[model samples]
Target: MQRVTKERCLEIISRFEPTKEGREKGHLGIDGFTAYLLSEECDIFDEEHKEVCQDMTQSFTHYFISTSHNTYLLEDQLKGPSSVDGYISALKKGCRCLELDCWDGPNDEPIIYHGHTLTSKISFQAVIEAINEHAFSKSEYVLYITNQNLIFLLLNIEE
Candidate 1:
């Protein structure tokens, strides 16, 4: 992202792109964009972007949350299955903002699922439990659980 040139773009895409097809086709996709954005070469002057930071005691607002839109979907929006795996993966990766699209489920329980046509459903309790297990495994930063179209579940944060 420093300089734009045919050679530089190709080198960046080829090395950072997630999929072989994208790397082969020489196009920058979302995953590749994220990789490049978080890569060291993205901001050579700023050492905070590196994997291991010298200081992590700064305020949450000072750093990017490393978040995503729909955290419970493993695949595309329409056909993906929602599960706690998504939450676990994000939490382990130090993602701070996680979204839970809760809806009234059978027997008075809340559930998380895609907002698309797919029927992927997982208990909201399961998602919360997973978060509790993994939220502090990576870092002690605050985690924001954004609930869409339903009651929110903000956990007890001790930091």
Candidate 2:
């Protein structure tokens, strides 16, 4: 990590009038300002502020998450094609949660595609495999999969 010098820190604080005055008055410097920003009085994280400096032990609901819907559809919902590339794309762009709409295919295997429409289908296993390969490439958090499936046995799909 690059260290912020006092000059650089002062320059940054100067953009805001209140902080600039505090720095000019010599009441706030790099170390003091950094400590003040992290202090409980700042209320940066609210009730969960302690978790900011420590490993997170809070429930997942306590945090905001980036999510995407119909993550397999690359284009129009009704007429476009579905592909694992869409999932890979969303995951690469920092989507921590994805929605996969699964439907029964003509073959024994389950496929992913938007249902009740004319969308093209992609192999469900292919999407899962793509997700497995790319889920953690951009993020350290657990990827949440919201599987919406029709009431049918999803067969011949491997992990």
Q: What is the Å distance of residue 89 in model 2 from its true position?
A: 1.0
Q: Mind giving the per-residue lDDT tens digits that candidate 2 earns over 1-159?
A: 179687765654554335545767645566666665765655445585423354457877887878899887878988998788888999897788888787788768888888899999889899889988888777667778877642222222337
Please tell me which predicted candidate would have the highest TM-score against the true structure.
1
lDDT at residue 104 of model 2 (Cα atoms)? 87
lDDT of 1 by residue, 1-159 (tens): 345789888998999999999999999999899989887677656565436564678865677667757888888788877778988998888787788888888999988887556859999898889988888787665677777654343454656
For candidate 1, the per-residue lDDT at 114 reads 73
Worst lDDT run of 10 residues, candidate 2, spans 149-158
Pairs of colliding residues, candidate 1: none
Clashes of each: 0, 0
